[model samples]
Target: MTNDELQQLAAGLANCGKALLRMADVLMEKKEDAPAAAEQKEPEKKLTLEDVRRVAADKARQGHMEEVRQLIQKFGADKLSGVDAARYPAMMKELEAMGNDE
Candidate 1:
């Protein structure tokens, strides 16, 4: 190839190398951000019967037995065990709120 053609080919290769480097940098940034994004989107922990029972027991120990019974009745359950498992989250929120009321 002519000298001018060879120099132009080398320059083109350099440009291509720079472009690939920029793309690599961008990909690295995304790789670093992925974990944080996943952490933010993670689902909240699921509530369990024992979890609700623990909170209720705590409230009752704090002398809120009557309030606890009222909360259970509000959910259409005559007792804690009678309350549906699906209601555990709402029940936990109310139970936590009871502590905050103090």
Candidate 2:
């Protein structure tokens, strides 16, 4: 191969390497920005009224009525279904913790 052709190929490779380095920098910036954006975002919950009731019914059917009643009383609700939406996640977590204990 001619020297001029080799020099052109070398230049092209250097340009490609610089382009890759710039792309890497852009990705690193996005990674740093992600946590800040995520912190500003409220965690999304997937629970529904039906889901709460269903999880409670499962508890009852499994002979966990005492635990269920305790949760209901703790939350000042008549039944699992009566628990407020905001408290449902906590309620479920308590129930889960109970299940985990045994």
Candidate 3:
């Protein structure tokens, strides 16, 4: 190939590499910022029935099942799995309060 043709190809490749680098920087920036944005935008998630049971079992393991049972009774739940999803947060909060009391 002519010298001029080779130079033109090299220049094109350099520009492409620069573009790829810019794109990489943009992507890396998003990845870096995503966690902070998520930390800010993600509200505390509502707990599920499984979450309630896990916490209850944790309490049970800690010899606090009586307190957990009391909370279940207050919620009209026969067992941790019986508690409504909507009330899981309240149950977890009460459990946390119970934990703090100990």
> What RMSD does each model have against the real structure?
5.9, 2.8, 4.3
lDDT of 2 by residue, 1-102 (tens): 999999999999999999999999999999999999988968766788887777777887888889889888899888766778888888877766666566
Question: Candidate 3, residues 1-102: lDDT per residue as tens digits?
Answer: 999999999999999999999999999999999998878866777777777788788888888888888889899878777777888888888887777765
TM-score versus the correct structure, for each prediction? 0.64, 0.67, 0.56
Q: Which stretches of candidate 3 lie above 4 Å from their native place?
A: 1-40
The clash numbers for all candidates, in the given order, read 0, 0, 0
Residue 43 shift from truth in candidate 1, angstroms: 2.1
lDDT of every predicted structure (CA atoms): 0.93, 0.84, 0.84
As for lDDT, the candidate ahead, 1 or 2, is: 1
Positional deviation of residue 42's Cα in model 1 after best superposition, in angstroms: 1.6
- After superposing candidate 1 on the true structure, give the runs of residues whose Cα lies further than 4 Å from its correct spot: 1-28
Q: Kindly state the number of residue pairs that clash in model 2.
A: 0
lDDT of 1 by residue, 1-102 (tens): 899999999999999999999999999999999999878866868888889999999999999999999999999999899999999999999999996855
Q: Output the lDDT of residue 78, model 2.
A: 82
